[model samples]
Target: MNENQSSRRRFVVSVGTAALVGLAGCGAQQGESAQTSTQQTTTQTETTTPTEAADTPTTTQKSSKSDADGPVVEMKTDNEGSYFDPKGLVVEPGTTVRFVNISGTHSTAAYHPDNDDGPLRIPDGADPWKSKLFTDTDAVFEHTFETEGVYDFYCAPHEMLGMVGRIVVGEPQGGPATESPTDIPPAAQESLPAVETIVSEQRVSGP
Candidate 1:
């Protein structure tokens, strides 16, 4: 072969090899870019899904203050007469009775065994029981009964005028109501002079 012909064939072969190498490089770059784009899309999807779930609301529950499995009783106060509206009350042991004083200048005082004034006597070894005195500025008294027996009480100032009450603490026998007689122990019962009931209005502040 001639020298110029050999040189032209060599140049053509080199140009063809160069074109194949450029094509392979471009194909590798395209495959790498496509893989990176797919990974970025997967990461974005994983991040956004949890954020959307966190924004949704979740359910919650609440509780009540009173138990539905216990017994309920109501007692009222009266001022038109010098006696408790329901002069007699019955409750089970460990029951709480709320005494709402309707008028002022009244108190529920237990009859001391010695029949004295200040403090009164409760049943032997029973939980200490005392109701706050509802005076001209105080109006409510609450007491919890924790023993089984009968309790007789009278007002400190009006015991002479027949202002008295009784509380029978225990489970009722035979589901019947027991009447409280005017004659209770520790205090003699006698019908006295009736006095007109006085209605007094007063505001009480809380501690």
Candidate 2:
């Protein structure tokens, strides 16, 4: 073959080889980009699934006491009488009773059958169990009934005029309204101070 023709053929072959190499490099780059995009999409999906599941609303359990089971009573002190509005309250063993004192100088005192006989007055280590005398303004108290029994309490200064209240804590086997009698301490029953029931109006605010 002639020298110039051989040189031209060699140049053409070199150009073709260079073009093939460039195309292979472009294919490899595209494959790597596709892999990276797929991985990012998978990661985002995994992160969002758990967050959406956590945001789902959960159901709350209801209390055992039905609306018809017991009456929602109030303890109020008014001009006519300074005493517990309902005079009595009934609750189940696991029920929680809230005492909102709206008026008068009063306290929910629950001493043992013999407060003077020893230090076994009221339950041991009860948290805010005893409500202090309401001399200044209105206050609120709450207690949970865990044991199945009756709890008798009297006002510190108004027990003489029969300012007493009872908490029947537990389910009655026979039927509703059945309660066991609570024993009041002798010292508490002896002489309760006589104080005028201070009547005051309380403003309760809520939505």
Candidate 3:
């Protein structure tokens, strides 16, 4: 072969090798950039996950007796025995009464014909309320008094034991509860608070 042709062939080979190396370097740089972009995307997704969890709603808590719409009554036990803590209460019409069981099994039942065929002790047109036996501590029941009259309630299982109470709504008015009770047990008759006393005192505690 001739000298010029050999030299020209060498130069061509050298230029081709340099071009391939440059292309390889560019490919490596592009691959690294793509990998970095993917890593940044994964990091962004991880950072937003905790914020989503923080935005989730939480459970609501139960309201306390002080937050009730009206007065609160507690069915509790003491050295004397099981009974309503405040034997009598006086409230305004449309007031709600919250009955909370502090201890032992008890219930807040109105003296009504629907409950054990008892005579109506609440106002004639007033709605009767009866609660199931509350055995769980802190169990609660609520009733709203729309009528302006006396209300006499008893604990069914403990009525004979004198677990009875009274409530006078607004001014004292005529009702079966205001009259002398004839159908109740002797203990309940003695334990029930007087409407006059409830009105004057606003609250009467048990004996």
Candidate 4:
């Protein structure tokens, strides 16, 4: 072939090769994008599955407390944080309060000036009592509320760590109002909000 024809043939071949390579590169990029989308969809599905499963049981338990197992007064004593579960509770007079030892070496000690470690906040004529540390079934403490007033108590060792609680028997009657955070030990600062919530929102009229 002549030089002119030869040059034209080479140019056409080069152009054809470049077009083929560009098409291949585009196919590869599209494949990668499709793969990435599938992986992201799978990750989202996995994440949502556990959350949906977890929420159902939690919602059901909170919404439905069976009458058979429910009680007039109950409280939890946790070992891990060395604090009571509810922080405060309100119950009727003559009701029995069952303290479940949920965690720790805990005790229920009435707040009294005679204890010399804390203030006196029990109801008028209410007897003061203290339970021994968790050493068996003694881990469980039960107190009957016979007076209509506020009773404050603490865990022996964890009181300094803010491990304290209160019980309001029947409706509040001439009891000290909601206590300020400044009145409690410095360690109990975190518990002040819970104290306020129970005192204001949980009080029940004695039946």
Which lDDT values do the candidates have, in the order given? Answer: 0.37, 0.37, 0.70, 0.49
The C-alpha RMSD in Å for every predicted model, in order, reads 37.0, 31.4, 30.9, 27.9
Q: Where does the lowest 10-residue lDDT sum fall in candidate 3?
A: 41-50
lDDT of 4: 0.49
> Model 2 over residues 69-111: C-alpha lDDT tens digits?
3333244466655565444444555555555556666665454
For candidate 1, lDDT tens digit of each residue in 59-177? 11112113252322222234444555445555566555544455545666555433343233334433332343444222334445655655555665555655665556663221111
Please give me the total number of clashing residue pairs in predicted model 2.
Answer: 0
In the range 5-45, model 3's lDDT, one tens digit per residue, is 11011111122222222234434354432222222111000
Stretches of candidate 3 exceeding 4 Å from the true structure: 1-62, 67-69
Clash list (residue pairs), candidate 3: none
Could you tell me the TM-score of candidate 4? Answer: 0.53
Poorest 10 consecutive residues of model 1 by lDDT? 41-50
The stretch of ten residues in a row with the least summed lDDT in candidate 2 is 41-50
Among the numbered candidates, top TM-score falls to 3
33-112, model 4: which lDDT tens digit per residue?
22222221110000001122211211011112223433322233334456665567777776556555554566666675
TM-score of each predicted structure versus truth: 0.41, 0.42, 0.68, 0.53
Question: Considering only N, C-alpha and C atoms within 3 Å, which residue pairs clash in candidate 4?
Answer: 79-103, 79-104
How many steric overlaps are in each model, in order?
0, 0, 0, 2
TM-score of 1: 0.41
Q: Cα lDDT for residue 98, model 4? A: 54
